[model samples]
Target chain A: MVEVEMNGTTPSVRDELITEIELSFGLLHKAAANFDNRYISRVFRDLGPLRRKLAKNGDALATVIDRLYPHNSASRAYLLEVTGKTDESMDEETKSAVKPEVDLYIHLLVQVYLLDNNRLEELNKFNDKVIYLLGSYNRRSLDFIQAKIWFYISRTKELIDDLHSIRPALLSALRSATLRHDTETAASTITLLLRNYLLCHEVNQAMNLVEKTEFPENAGSSLVARYYYYLARINAIQLDYSSANEYVIAATRKAPQTQLAVGFLQAATKLSIIIELLMGDIPELQLFRKQSDSLEPYFMLTKAVRLGDLKLFEEVLKKYEQAFKKDDNFTLVSRLRQNVIKTGIRIISLSYSKISLKDICIKLLLDSEELAEYIVAKAIRDGVIEASINHEHGYMKSKELLDVYSTKLPQDDFDQRIKFCLSLHNDSVKSMRYPSADNRSDINKHNLAAKEDEMDLLKAIEEGDLDDFMD
Target chain B: MSLQKLTAELYQLYDQEEYEKCQKILTPIKLELIKHNLLLPTVANSDSKDKINDLKIAERILEIGALSSLLSNNYRGFENYVAQLRPFYSNKQIHAKPEKNTDQTKIISLYLLYLLSQGLVSKFHVELELIYNSKQYNVEQDQYLLFPVNLEKHLMEGNYIKIWKVLKNDTNLPCKEYGHFLDTLVNALRFEIAKSLEQTYETIPISNCKGLLYFPQEQSDATFESIIKDDLKMTGWTFKDGSITFKNDDDSHKGNVNPNSINLISNVLSYAERIESIV
Candidate 1:
C-alpha cells in the first residue's frame, strides 16, 4: 500500500491506491460498527489524501475510483450528500458490497463539514435523511446508527440553541436503544434527553424520565457518571441539596479520567462543593488538591466560600466569568454570594455570641444596621445559627450549644437514608421490564409467594380470634 | 444553476436584507464548490499557481457569508466563515492591496463590536491580540479597524463619554451592520450609566441626563423619558420645575444588586437543618 506512486504513472499504482482506499473504507465501517469515534475520525483523515491522489491521476481507472469515492463531482446528488443535504436520491450506488457503509461515511463527513461551517440548513437536511433511512429500514437492527445520528442531531440543535425542538428525535433514539438493549447508546441518549430537559427548566419531566427509564445494568462508567451528574443538577434545581450532594459525589467518583469525563467530574465537584457549603459544611481540604490544575478556579472559589470573603468571591467570579459561563455554572456561582454572607454571619455569631447589630453590620460589611438585623433574623429563622435577635436592644443572643449525644438528629438521618433506599427499590421495580417471555414466569412466581404469605397471615389472625373465645 | 448566477442572487438578497433567502441561495453554491473540490484547498499539496482563481472565488464566497451572518447577528455563523478566511488573509495571498481591503476591515470591525456587545471582554482582547500579532495586520495600513479597538479600550476604562464621542465623531463605521451593533453598544453604555446613577445620585435634572448619555439633539425629550421610564423601568421620577427627581425606592436598590444573582442560601438552609437533624 505504501509503494503506490503519487504521480500514478502506471496501472499497478492505481490498483494499489484503489485497494488501499477500499481497505480504509472497511476500517471505517468497523470503526462505525464499534462506535469508535477516534478510529472513525482517523480513517476519514487517512482517506482524504488517497482520494485526492486518485483524483489527480485523471485515468479511466481513476474515474472508476472516483465513481466509488466520488472525491469531487459536480452532480447535484453528489453535492447534496457531500454538503449534508441528505434525502436526495440514493439511486447511484456503486454496485459494491460496501455501498451502504460508503454512503454512511460520506454522510457523516458532510455532516462534520456542515457542522464546522455552522450550516444549520444542511445539517437539518442530513438529520432528515437519517430519520428517513431509519424509518425505511429495520430500526431495531440499526439502533447503533440511529443512536449515533440522533447524538449528532441533538448536538447540532443544541449548538444552534434549538434544544427544545429535539424532543422527537431524542425520544426515538432512546426508544430504539432501549428496545435493542444497547446499554451505551441508551445511557448516552438518556443523558442527552435529560440535559435538554434541564436546559429547558422542565424539572418535572426530567425527574419523571429518571424514574421511568430502565438504564441497562451494564452501562459504561462514564455514562453512569453522566446520569448521576444530571440527576444532581435536577435535584439541585429542585432544592434537594442532600440528595443532590449524594448524586454529585457518586458522579464524581464514577466519572472516568478521559478528557470529556474530566470536565464532567470538574462540574460535579463544583456543584458538590456548592451543595456542601449551602448545607453549612465545608468541603474536605483534600478535594481541592485531588483534581487537575484546570480546576484551580473552583478551589479558589471553595476557599472564598469557606472564609466568607465576599470581595474575594466576587473577584474569583469575575476572573473566571467566561469559564463559568462555558460550564453553565455562572448562575450557580453568582448565587454563592448570599451563602458567603450567611457564612460570615455564622462565623460572627460563633465568635461574638452577644454582638450588637452595629458590630454585626461592620463584621458582615452590610450598608446598614437594619440590613444586618434583617439578615440575623433570617438566619435565626432558617436555623443557620442557634441565636435570637433582640429587636429592642439591637443585639443577637446565642443559646448554649447542646451535647451531640442528646440530639435525635442522627436517628432522623438514618430514617431519611432508609426512606431514600426504599424509594430507589420502588423506582427499580417500576422501571424493570420483562422483555422476554421467560422473565415473566419469574415475576409470576414472586407474586405467588407474596399472595401465599398474605393468606397465611390472615389464617393466623382468624385462628387467634377462635382461641381467644375458647379461653 | 451557474455559480456566477447564484453568487449574483446571493448579493442581491443580502443587499435587500433578506439574509435567510441569501443563505438558501448560498448553500447550493457552497455545495457545488465542495463537490468541485474548490471550497478549501490542501495548500501543502496543491500548487498555488494552478488553483489561484478557485481560491479567489472561495475567498469571495466566505466573505459574503461572513457579512451576511454579521448582518443577521449570527456570531457563531460569522465565526465559521471567518475561520475559513483566516488562512487566506493571514497568508497575504488574498487582499494583497491594502486599499482594496476595506471589506475585510469592516468584517473584523463588526466581529470586534459583536464581542464587545456580548460583554465578552476576554474574547475581545484575544481577538485584538491575534490581529496585533499577525504579520499582515499593520495598524497604519488598516486604520479602519481601529474604531472597535478604541471603543473597547474606552469601554474597559469606563469612559462612556469617550465612547460616545468616538461613535458620534467618526463617519467611517465600515458598513451598515456597524450601525446595528453600535446601537447595542450604546444600550449597554446606557445601562452602565443607569447603574452608576442609582449607586451615586439621588436625582439629576433630565437635561443633564440627556447630556450625560449623549442623546442625539434630534431625539425628543419624550423619547428619552420613555427609554428611562419604560425600558429602564425607572419610575417615580418627578418631572416638574424643569427637573426630575429620582425617588429612592426598592427599584433603585434592585439595580444595585446584580439581577442574575439568585438567593439559594435561604432555601438551602431551610432544607439543610432538616437534613442535618435527620443525619
Candidate 2:
C-alpha cells in the first residue's frame, strides 16, 4: 500500500473509502467475469461491512454510493469499472467525464440483470434513477448518449409491459436528437414512439404524434416501413381495410430485404392478408409462401377465407390457436368468421344471376330464411355484391358486369393518392427549419441595409443626382 | 422523517385523492427502503425482525400507492407497484399478505377491470392465466375476481342482457372503485347490443328495444331514443309513438367492403386458370 503523510494535505476519509470500494469492485469484476459464484457471494457479503465503515467515518458519500448502487451485488462489476478513477487527486473534468459513463454503465448493467431475472419492479427503480441522473446532467450536447439511454429506458418499459410509459421516454429521446440536430435518430425514435402508442391501442395518440411530429422526407427505409406498418395497424383497428391494405402494401414494398427485417416483413404480410380478407379480396397464394413455415397458419387462414369455408376457418383457428394467441392475433383471427360468411355470399351471388333466399339459407348454413335475407340485404347495401334483394319475391338478382374500367372509382383512388401526397408535402413544409431567434440580428442588419439604400436613393433625388442614378 | 410517518402521510394524501403528492412523498421513503433491501420480505431478509415489520409497512404503502395510481389513471405506476407486490405474494418464504379489506384480490379485480375497459382481451387472458398458474388464491370464492371472470365470459358469449343484469343487480362490487369500471363495462355491453341489433333488424318496436337494451322501466322512451341517436350515432332512426324504424340505405354496408372486390374475383379466377395450366 502507498502510504501518505498524516497531514492536512492527506486525502479525506471519503476519498480513502472510495479507493477501497474501487479495489473491491476490481476484485468483484474478476469474480463475475469468471462466473465464480462463491467469490461473488463473498464480494456481496463484504459490501455491508464496507458501507458500515464509510458510515462510521462520517462520509456522506456512503449514502450517495448506496443510492447509486442500491443492489450493490448485481451492479458490483459495473460500479467498479465506472468509479475506477474516483480518486481525490483526479481532476474535476476527468471526474465529470467518468461520472456519466459510470451512471450509464450502472443503468445498463442493472437493466441487464433485471431483464434476465424478470425483476420489473427493480427495473422501474433503476428507470427512476436514470431519469433523475439525466435531469441533473443536462448535457444536451451529448445527444447520442441521451438517445441511447432513453432508448434503453423505453425498451425496459416495454419489457415490463408498461407500454404507456414508453411514450414519454421516447419523446424525450426525440427532443434530445432534435436539440442536437440529429434528425435520423429523431425520426427513428419518433417511429418507435408511434409504435408504442399503437401497441397500447392508443390509435388517436399515435395519429396525433404523426400529425404533430415533423418526419423528414428522406427517412430511412426501415423506419418508413415501420411507420407504415403501425399506420396500417391503426387503420385496420379503425375498420378502414382499404387504407390499411394500401399502407401494408407500402410497408412491404419499402421493407428492407435483410434477415433481421424478416420478422417485420412477416408481420406486414399477416396484416395485409387479414386486411384483404376483411375487404373481401383474396390475397395471392404466392404472398403466403414467402416466409415458408413461419407463415403457414396465415396461409391456411387465407385458404379457408378464399374458399369461404366457415368450418375450415374454425378448424384452422383451432389448429393454430396457440400460435395465434402467442402472437396476440387470435382476436383478429376470430373476426375472420364473419368475413368467411360474406365471402360465401359473394361467391354465391357471382355464380348465379338469381338465387332464392331459401336456397341461400341452405347453401350458406343459415339458421333461418329471415337471417339469410337480412345477410343478403346487408351485403347488397354494403356494396359487397352488385345485386338487388327482391324482398317480395324472396330472390336475389345479381347485375351483369359492366366494362371493368368504366367507373369513377379509379379517379377516386387517384384523388386519394393525390391528397395523401399533398398532406405529406404539407407536413414536410411544416417541418422545414426556419431562422431562429439567434439569426434575427442578421435579418435586422439586412433590413437596415435596404433602408440605407432607400435613404441614399431619396437623397440622390433630393440633391438632383439623377445623373448618377441613370448611370 | 421516519418511514412510518411518511407512510402515514402517504395514506392520508392518497385518501384525499392527492395522488401526485402521494407519489412525491413516497419517493424518498421508497428509495430508502429499497437501499436497505427492505421494500419486500425476501428470503434473505425475512429473519430480521425490523425488516419484517418494515416489509409489512412497505407493502401497505405500495398497496395504497397502487390504488392512488389507479384512481389517477396512472396505469404504469399502478403496474409497477403491483409488480413489486407480486414477489411477496408469490414467494413462499415471504408470507406477507395484505391486511383485511385491502386485499390482493381487490387490486387484481381493479386491474382486470382496467384491462376490460381498455378492450385488451389478450392481456386480460394472459393475466388471468398468470393468476391461475400462480395458485395463490381461491379465485372462485373471491367475489371481486369472480365478477371480472363472469363478466368476461358473458361478454364473450354475447350475453349482453346477462351482463346488464350483473351490472344492475349485483350490489357487491368489492369497493367503490369498481363502480366506475362497472359503468364502463355496462356501456360497452350496451354498444355491443346496439351493434348486433342494428345488424339484425331494419326496424324494431320501441318497447322491444327497451328489453333488448336492458333499459330500466323508470327510464323514459325519449331517454332511450336520445341514447341511441346521440350516443350510438344511429341518425337513420325514426321514433314514432310506439315503434322505431331504422332507415335502410341501399348503399350502406354493416362492415368493410372492398370497392375492387369484383376485380379481385376476376384476378383470382385468372390465377386459378394459370395454376391449372401449369399443373
Candidate 3:
C-alpha cells in the first residue's frame, strides 16, 4: 500500500486566511455599533445566507478548518471526520446525521463558553486576535470602538476616558443606544462610570451624573435598584444620613424582591447604623441595625442603655458575647467598642451599688489602673456617680468605675457637655499631694489627691478631649 | 496559598538567579492576581529575583506591565487589552478601537508608575529608581523601559534643562513633540507663585493659620460653640463629621444640602487638567 501524507500549510496562506477572518470581524463590529435591536435581528437573519452557502459545501468544516488553522498539521484526522470526507468511511446513517460547518459554529460558540466558564486563557487569546485586527484603524474610529469595549467590560476608568475622549460623538451614540432599548449598554456604561467616580472619592460627580440619568422605560428592575443602591452608598459615604436613607427606600421600592436587591438593602442598612451613631441617635441606630446581621447586636446593646432598660442591656450583652468572642477583632469595632466600654461603666456605677467599680473594670479587662480612676472621675462629673468624700460607701470603690464611663461621648452640640463633665470632675476632686506625708490630715488629703490622679490617667476620657482637636 | 507566600517564592527564585523558574511560577498566576484588582502595597515583593541578570528579569517584568494595567483603579491599560478581546466578547455592534501610540505610552507609563510607587513591581522600587535616574539613561535615545522613568522625573521637575542638553535629549523624549512644554508650565507657575508670595511675604499676616486654610470670604454657622458643643462630642465620630457636614441640611444649614461633594469633584477635575497640561 502507498502512503500519501498531506503537505503542511504555508505561512502566506495562513496570513491570507487570517486577513479574511479579520475583515468579517470588522464588519460584525461595525454592525454592533448601531446597537439597534431591529438591525441586530436583521443581521442575524442576513447571516442565514452565509449559513446556506456553508451548507452546500461538501467539506465545509474541513474547508473552514483549513482556512482557520491550516498550519496545524495535527488536525487532519479531526478535520476529515468533521467535514464527512474521511476515507475510513462511516456508516451512511451517521454520515447523514452530521452537519456541515458544525466546527465553525462551535468555534463561535466557544467565545461565549470560555467567558461563562471563566477560562480567561482562551478568552485572552481571542482578545489578542481581535486587537491585532482592529488596532490599525484611524484615531476617531479607534476611540469609538475602544469606548464601546470599555463600556461593556465595566472597566470604569477607561470607560470614563473613552466617554470623554469624543464627548459629543460618544454621548450621541449612547443616546441613540438608549432610544433603541439597548438597556444593557445604558446601564453598564452609567454604572461603571458611577463606580469609578465613587472609587476616586468623587462623590459629587457621581451624584450629579446619577441624578441626571433617567431610567429607561423597560429597564430591568434589578438594574434600576442597583443604580439607586449605589447612589445611596455615595450619600452614606458623604454622611448624608437622611438622603442615604431616602435613596435606599427608593431603591427598595424600585427593585424587585430578588437576592441581589436584598443584598443591596443589607449594605444600605449598615451605612444607616454608622450614620445614626455619628448623629448621637442611639435608638434610631438600633432600629436600622435590625436589617443588617453585622451591626444588629451592637446597636441593640446601645439601644438598651439609651432607654435605661437594664434587663434588655443584660440580655443583649449575653447574646452579644456569645456571637462576638472576647478576642474577636469585631469586638473592638470602633463604634461598638466605644459604646461597650463607656456604657458598661456608666450603668454599673450609677445604678448597681452591689457590683464594685473594680468588678466592672475586671469584667471589661480594663486593668489599667489609670483608666479606672479617670472613668470613675468622669462618672462623678456627669452626675452619673456622686462625688462623696466618704471612702466606705461612695468613695473610690472599684465596682463603681463602670457607671462613670457609660454616657455617649457627646460631639458638636454636645462637645461642651463633655468638657463640662471634665471640668466638674476637676473642680470637686483634690489634687494628689505626695512627698511622704505622716500627719493624719495630710494623709487623708493625699488619698483624695491620689483618687484624682486616676482620673487624669484614664485613656478613653482623654480620647474624648482629644476629639476636639481632630475635626 | 497567600499572595505573600507566592511573592516570597517568586523573590526566592529571583534571588537564586532562577529567572526562568520565577517567570514560570508567576506567568500562569499573573492574570489571576491582576484580576483581583489588589492594591500594590498588598502585593509582596521578594528579593530572590535580584540575583538574575537584569535582562532576564525584564522578560518577567512584562507580567508587571500586564498586572499594572489590570490592577489600575483608573483602568489605564484595560482599553488596550479589551480592544484585543473585542472579537471574542463584542457583539456585532461593537469593535475594538485602534489605540494611539502616544496615548498608549502615557497610559502604560502612568499605570507602571502607579504600580512602582505603590510597591507592586517584581523588583524593588529603589532598583527602578536607580535605573531611572542614571545619567546614561536617555529615554528617547533608549527604549520604552527607559522612557517611563524619564517621563516621571521630567513630570516631577516640570522644567526644562539647559539648551544643549534639551537639544540633545529632545529628539529622544516623547514630550519634545509638545515643544518642551513642561518647562513653560513650571516657569509660569514659579513666576506666579513667586510674584504672589513675594507680595504676601511683605504685607500679609501669617498669624491666622485657620483663617488662611479655610475659605476666608465665606461665612459659616459652625461657630466655636457649635463646633465644640454640637460637633465634637468625642464618642468616636469626628471622622463622621467631615463626611456629614457636606451632606447635613437640617440644623447645620436647613433647606440646603452642602455642595461639598461638588467642590471635591471639581478640585480633582482641575488637578487632572493641570497634570494634562504638562503631558
Candidate 4:
C-alpha cells in the first residue's frame, strides 16, 4: 500500500480523496447542527466521484476517520480497526468530535469500498458492528444515511447468498423506522424485505407483507419504483397479468431517467413485454427500441408471438433459456407457449375465413390435424379468436366480424384509459408533499432558494440513488 | 389426553387408514399446538431442536388434515389445510434441506391438482412459479410433483388425447389419493372437448364423437347422448342418420342492441355539459 502511494501517479489521486472527505465532513457537521438534510444531500451529490476514489484507495477511509474522530473515541478506533490500518503520527490539532451521521457515512464508504474490491467476507463480518451502531442512534438526520447503509448491508448478504438471516434485522428496522416516522428508512427496509422474499420465491409472504404494511406516501421515488417493480413481479407470478401490467408500467415511469438507471429500465421493460404478451396484446415495437441495451431476446420473442410462429418461439426460448432464467422470467416465458399457439390460430382465422384443419396443421407446423383442431377449439373457448369448427367437415369458419361502431370494445378501451389517467392524477394528488416552510409573505426569495434545493436533491437522486436498482 | 399421546394416536390411526378418527383428534391437537406456541414456527420458539421437531409434528398433522379432508370428500377443508400448511413449508427451520417423496411434496402436488381440476389455471400457474423456483422442492424429478405439472402442459396445449392418456393410465398416478380426482378431472376434460367439438363441427359421426369424448366403444348412443346433454349441457346437438348435428344457439343473440347504451349516452351528455361550461 505504501509503495503504491509513493508513486507520483497515485499520490495525487489519494490526496484528492482526502480533500473530498474533508469537504464531506464539513457538510455533515453543518447538517447535524442545523437539522437540515439538504446539506447531507449536498454531500451525497458528489458521492459518485468519491465512491470511485474510495473503492480504488479504501485506505483513505482511515484518513477520514482519524480526521473526524478524537483519538480516544470508540468510533475512530472501531473504524480504524475495521479498515485494518493505523495512523501513529496523528497530531493533537487534527482530532474532531464524531457525529452518528459521520460515523454511518464513513461505514457506508467502507461498505462500498469492500464491495468494489470483492471483499465480501470482510464486509459480512463488518456488518454486525455497523448494525449495532445504527441501532444506538435515534436521530432523524440519520434516516437517509441509515437507509443507504442498510441497502449496502443487504447487498453484501445477498452477494454471500445468505438471504434468510437478514430478515429479522430488516423487519425490526422496518418497525422502528415506521414508529419513528422515518419514511426513507421505512421505505428502504420494505423494499429490501420484498426483494429478499421474491429472491426466494416466497410470493405468499411477500403478498401478505404488502397487504399488511402501508408504504409511506412520501417515500423517495426510487424506492417507490422498486416497490412497484417487486409488486409487478409478484403479481405476474400469481397470474394477474392486467394488474401486473399496470404496476410494471408504473415502475418504468417512476424509474430515474438517467444513464445510471438503464439496467432497471431494461429489466422493467422486459417484464412489461412478457406481461403484455400474456395479456394477448402485442407490445409496440417502440417499447423494444427504447432500451439502449440489446433486448434481442424479448424482441425476438415478441416477433415470434406476433408472427404466430410456435417454432420460432421455441427456438428463442431455447436460445435465451439461461438469460430468461437469470432474469427470473423463465417460468413466465415458458407459459407463453400456449400464447404462441393462440396467436397462430388467431392469424390463421384472420387470413382465411374458412380453412381446413389439415391446412391449419401444416401452417402451424402441427404434428397432425387432430392437434390443430383441438388447439383452435381451445383458442375459441379462451376468447383468443372468434371462430367455430365444423367437426364432421373438419373445417373452421371464422365468425362474421362484429360492427366496430356498435360493439362496446372501443368504448371499453377508451373508458379504461380515462380511468387510468384519473387514477394516476388522484394518486399524485394524494401523495403530494407540502413544503413545511411555505411562506407567502416572502415568496420570491423562498421560491428561488427552494428551486435550487430541489435541483440539488434531484441531482443527488440521479447521481447516487440508483441503489434500489443495483440488484 | 396429552398432546404427545394424541399425536401418537393420530399417527397410529393414519397408519391404520382411519382418516375419519384421525380428523376428529386433529381438531383438539391443533388447539393444543396453538396453546403451546408450536403451531407456526417463529424466531422465538423455533430456535431449538425440540421446538423444531414439535413444529415438524405440527406440519405432519396439517398434512394429515389436508389428505384426510380430500379422502373424506371435504374439499373446502382440504383447501383450508393447504393454506394453513403454507407457512410451515416456507419456514426455513423445517425445510432446510430438500426431501424426496415426502408427504409435503405429495400434499403440495395434490393442491396443484386441485387448482387445475377447479379450472383455476391462473392460480395454478402462480403456485407453480413458487414450487419450481424454491430450492427445497424439485418440480421436475419429484414423482408427485411431475403429475400435475405435466397435466397442465398438455391441457394448455389442447392435447386432450395426452391428458386422456395421463388420466386413463393408473400407473401415471403417483398415489392412491390421486384416484379420487379421476372422475371429476375426466368430466372436466370431456366438457372442454365437447365445447370444442360443437363449435368445430356441423355434424360428427357418432362413433368419432364418442371417441373424442373418451366413451367406451360399445356404449349405446342413447346413453352417450344422455350423458352429453345432461352433463355437458350440449343441447344444440341433434342425432340423425348415424351422425350428430350441432344447432348454433348463439345465432339468436346476434345483432342485439348494446345493453349499456343508455349509460354511455348519459356519460357523453355530461361530458358535453362540462365542455360547454369550460368553453
Candidate 5:
C-alpha cells in the first residue's frame, strides 16, 4: 500500500481520479435534484477509494477542477490559486454555472488532496478562503458538504499547530450552523470545537461550551459518539466519574463497529477502564486480553489497581508515565492513588472482620496508622467499604455483609429494566416509518389491495399515535 | 476621566495598598473601555502593533481590577475581572513572546486558591487542566502557581497531613495575596478532617480529636464542641467524659421505615384490578 501511494502522480492515476470525482459529481447532482441526502452519503461512501487515489496522485485534483469549472470563474480562480502550481491549467471557455453542492464537494476534495499531500501551509490558506465560500453558500443541501469542509479546515489548522488562529472562524461557524437549524453542521462543528478545546487542555471552556449549547437530538450517530467521547473526557477531568463512565460506555456502544473505528474504540476502552478504577470498581480481566499491544500499559495498570497494591500501582505509574501522559490520562491515573488505597482498605475489610489500624497501615504502605484510619473512614463515607474505624481502639471492623436479595436493590434494578424496556418499545414505535409517496406507489398501488385499511392506519399513526398508545 | 489619568491613579492607589479606593475608581475606567470598544479584545483589534498596545492597556486595567478586588476581599468581583482578562491572555497579543508574566501567574494562582478554599474541586481541576498543559505557564517552576497546584494534589491524594503542613507554614506562602486564602483554606481543610474524624472514631479523647482537626490544644473545649456542632454539622456526636463519641447514622435509621401497609395494600389491589380487567 505504501509503495502504491508512493508511486505518485502517474497519468493513468490522474485520469482515474478525474473519472471518480466526475462520477461523484453525478451523485451530488442526484442528491440536489432529488433533495435526498443518501446520494450524498453514497458520495462519501466513495471517499475511501478517492482518498487512496488522491494520495497516489494529487495533481489530478487540479485537472478535475479545470474540467469542472469554467474559465475565469471566481471559484475556479480561487481554487487554482490556492491549489498551487499544477502540471497544467486547462480551462474551457464556457459560461456555465456550477452547482453550489458540486462547488463545496470539490472544495472538500481539494482539502483532502492537500492534506494527503502534506501541503499544510497551502491547505491552511486554501481553507481560509473556503470558510468564506462556506459562509456565502446558504443552500440547505450544502449542509453536509459544508460540515465536512469545516472538518478539513480545522484539521488543516490543527496540523499547522495554529489552533488559536482558527477559533474565531469555528465559533462563528458553530453559531451559523445553530442559527440555520443545520443539525449535521452544528454537530460536526461542536465535535470539532470540543476536540480543539480538549487538545488545548481547556476543560473549563469546553465545559462552558457544553453548558451553553444543546447537542442536536437528530445528529448522526458517529458524530454523537465523538461528542459523547469528548463529554466523557471533560467529565472525567472534572472528577465526575459516574457520568463519565456512562458517557464512555455509550460512546463505545454507539461507535461504528468497523475496523476503521478501532482507534476510537481503543481510546474509549482505555478511558472506561481508568474511570472504573477511579470509581473503585476493577475492570474485568477480559478487557485486558483483547489482543492489542497498545493496551499493554493499561493492562498492567489495571492489574496493579485491581490487586489493590499501592507499591505495584506506583511502579506501574512510573513505568507507563510517558504513555499515560501521551494518552492524556496521567492526571486521572494519578488520582487512582487514593482509589488504590481505598481498594486496599476494602479488600482488608472484606477479609478480616476486625483488624488493627497499624496492620491496615502496614498492608497499604501508608505513612501511619492515623492516615490509615482517616483513609478507611473516608472509604466508608464514599461507600467503598462497609466498615468502620474505632479510633479509640485503633482497630477497624467490617460490618456484616447483607444478603443481596433482602435489600431494596433488586426492586431498583427491576424498575430500571422495566423503564429501559419501555423506552426501547417507544423508540421502536416512533422510528417505524410510513412509506413515502414515491416508495409506496408500487407496493401500495399494486401489491396492497387493502388501500383503505392502509389509509386508516396511516391516519391513526399521524393523528392519534399517542391516543392509541395511552389507552 | 481619561484612561491614562484613571490608570495612573489606580496604580498609585494599588501601590499605597488602598485596594478599596482602586475598586471605586475601576468602574468608570471599565465603562470608558466599553465606550472605546476596547473592553474585550476582538479579532479586528488584536493584530496590528498599535491596536495590540491599546489592548495591552485594557489588559492591564482588568488585571488591576482583578488584583484589587482580590485584595479588597471582593471575591466575586475578582472572579468577574479574571474572566474578563482571559480573552486578553489568550488573544496572542499581550505576552505573546512566550515570556512569563508574574502578574498573570499570581492572579491565576489566587483564583485557583480561591476555588480550592471554597471547595470547588471540579472547577479547580478544570482550570488546572489548562495551566498544566499550556506551554506558556510553567506550573512546577512558578512558586505562585505551584502553591495551589500542590494543594489540589494533596487534597486529591487524601494526604491531609501534607496539606495542613503547607497551609500552616505562613512563611512558605509566595505573596501577601496568598495569605488571604489561608484562613478559609485551613478552615475548609479542617472541615474535611472533622467529617472524617466523625466517621473514623466511635469514641476518642477530645484532645486527640482536636489534634486530628488541627485545632490548637490551647483552645477551650467548649469552643471546639460548638465549632463541631455548628460548623461541621456533626449533630449526632456526643461530647462527655472528656471524650467524643461518634453516633453511626445508619444504625439509628436502620429500622425507622417499616413498610407502609396501606400503600402496599392499595398497590396490590390496583394490580389485582388490572389483572381482573385483563381476564
Candidate 6:
C-alpha cells in the first residue's frame, strides 16, 4: 500500500485539503438524505470546490481517512463513503473525478455482504447506500449483484408484514440506480420490480410502472415472456381480457424457443384466452388451446386449478396419472400427482353450482376438512370462485359457480361470436315432431332429466369452454 | 458614444419614414439578441410577411455593399458570433405555463409586448430577459383575460350597456346576432391553439402566413370581416374616406400616433423611416 505523507509543507496545505474533503463528504451525505432533489443541493453547496479538489488530488481524501480513522466504524463508513454510491451531488466534474474509487467501494461492499450472510444488520444499515450504488452503477453486470442482495434481504424465507418497508426502499434503490440509457439494466430492473409488484398484489402500480418502462427491443425471449405474463395476469385480475390478449400475443412472439420459458408463457397465454372467454372474446380460444397443449401435463394442471375449468381439470389429471404410471416410481411422483389431483378436485368444486364440498373430497380421496378447505380457499382467493351468498358461514357463503363469472358481453366483434353461441343454445328450441310415443320409449322415460344436466354442462363447455384452461 | 445617441439615430430614421433603413441600422444591434438566442421572428401573421419583405431589402442592401456602412460588424463576424451562440441556444429551455392560471393575463400580455420591445431595443440585457418558448402562451395566457372582450364571458356580463355598445354600435354583424358569430370564432380559436400546442415539440409558430387567412382560394369578404371586426377597431377608419383612424377615449389626444407625446410619434416615425431607407 502506498503511504500518504502528511508533512507536505506542514499544516497549511493539509488543513486546506482536509477542509475540502470534509466539505465534499458533507455534500455527499446531504445528497443521500435528499437525493430526489439533487439539483437544489448542488446549487446550495456549489459543486465547484469538490470538483476542483478532486481534479487537484486523486483519492487523497480516502488516503487521509485511512491515515486518521484506521479501522473504526467511521473508517468502514468512510470506506463505504469511498464508493460514492449516490451521484446526486450537483457537480458532474466531481462525479467523474472520484468514480473509480466509488466503483471499487461498491463492488467491495456488495461482495462482503453477499459472502457473509450473517451481516443482516450491516446490510440493513447500508441498505440505502447499496440501493444508491445499484442505481448509480453503469455496469449491466451488477444487475444480479444488487438484486440478489435485495432478494436475500427482503425475501428471507417467507414474507412478513414489515416486508412492506423494504419494498419502497427497494423500488427507490432501483429508481436511483437504473439509468435511462442502459437498456439491459432498465429491462432487468423492470422485470424484477414487476414480479415483486405482482407478488405483492399491487397490480395497478406494477401495470403503471410497466407502461412507463422503456425496455430493450432485442431482449431475450424470457424477458418478453415475463413482460406479457405480468400484463396478462393483471388484466386477468382486472377482468379486461381483450387488453390482456394484446400483451399475451406479444409474449407468444418471444416463445417457441425455450421450453422452460414457454411453459410459463404457454400458461399465461392460455390464461389470457380463458379471460377472453370470461370477458366473452371466444374467437381466439382455439388459438390459445393449441399453444397450451404443447406444454407439459404438470404445467397445465396448475392452470386448470387457477382457472377452475372442470373439463380441463379432469383431462390434465388423467394425463398426469398416465405419465405417473409410465414412470412406475409412484413414491417420487406421488406428491406431484397429489397436487394435480387437488387442483382437479378444486376445479370441479368451483365450476359447478350443485357440486358439494363432500362430493369434491370423495372424488379426490382427500380428508373432508383440511385439503378440501385449502382448495376452496385458494379457489376463492384466485377469483375462480366468486363470492355469492350472504350466509352466516363466511367461506361457504362466499363460494360461487363458474357461471357467475360470465359478465356483460364485450360490445365489439367478439360479442358477435358470443351472441351466436348464445343463439345456438337459446334462440331456437329443437323440436322432434313425431307421432306421440304409443308407450313412451323407456330410454326417454327412464331419465331425460339426468341427460339434460349432462348435456347442459357439455354444451356450456363446448360454447365457452373453448378456453385453453388447462394450461 | 452614448446609448441615447443610438436611440436618437434610430428615432430619426423612423421619423423620416425610412423603415428599411431603420431595420438595417437595427440589424447590428439585433445581433446582440441573436447572440443570446432571443431574435424570435415576429409571431403576427402580418408581421411575418413584413419580415420576408424586410429580408429582401437586406439582400438588396448587401448587393449594393451598403450593409457594412449600415452594420458596424462585418457579415462574416456576425456569422461567427451566431455560431458561437448556437450551443447556448440549443441548451435553453422555458417552463410550461402552469395549468392553474395564477398569472394575470393582462400582465402576461404586457410582458409579451415588453419582450417585443426588448427584441427591438439596441442594447438588451440577457439577465432581465424572460423568453416565451411556447405559442399557446398568447392564446391561453393573454387572449382569455387580457383582451378587451373575452368571448366566453361576453354573454355573461352584467354591464348590459357595454355589451349593447360592443354589439349594435360596432360596425360588424348586428349586436343581436353577435353571440352566434363570436361564439364560433372563440371555439375555433381555442381548438386551433390547443391542437397546435398538443402536436408540436419545438418552438411553434404562434402565427402562420397571413396569406393563408387574407387570400383564400375563394373570395369571402363578409366571412373575413365578421371574424376580425373587433381587431379592426384598432387599425382602420371610415371605409368611405379610406383614412386610418383610431378610437380615442378623450379629445386630449390629437392623432393616431399620439402627436402630443414628446418623442412617441418621432420615435415611431424614425423607426419607420430607417426601415424604408434600408429598402
User: What are the C-alpha RMSDs, in order, of all predicted structures?
Assistant: 18.4, 19.2, 29.4, 4.5, 6.7, 33.4
Tens digits of per-residue lDDT, candidate 1, B1-279, equal: 487788778778877889877666777988888776777655552467657666777777888898887777777888898878766665445445553346777677677778788887645644554465444566445656777777765453344656675566546565566777777777887766665444333455666657555676467778887888787666666566645665645454344344222433543454566456547
Summarize candidate 1's per-residue lDDT along A75-143 as a digit string, tens digits: 334434433234333456544443454555444444544554567776776677666655554423234
Residue-wise lDDT of candidate 3 within A1-471, one digit each (tens)?
Answer: 001111234445535443443444443444346332222222233233343333333233344444443333333354444344554433333222211122223333233233333445444455443333323322222332332343323332232333333333334445654565556446645655665555444455676786787655444345556667677666654445577666766666565443424555555454444445433345454455455566666567557656544456567756776443321212122223333344555555566554544565565566444334334443443334332222123234333232322322222235455445555555444342333444456546668764453334332222211100100
Q: Which ten residues in a row are the worst by lDDT in model 2 chain A? A: A462-471
Task: Show how many residue pairs clash in every candidate, following the order shown.
Answer: 4, 1, 49, 7, 0, 30
Least well predicted 10-residue stretch by lDDT in candidate 6 chain A:
A462-471
Q: Could you tell me how far off, in angstroms, the CA of residue B257 lies in candidate 4 after the best superposition?
A: 6.7
Docking class of 6: incorrect
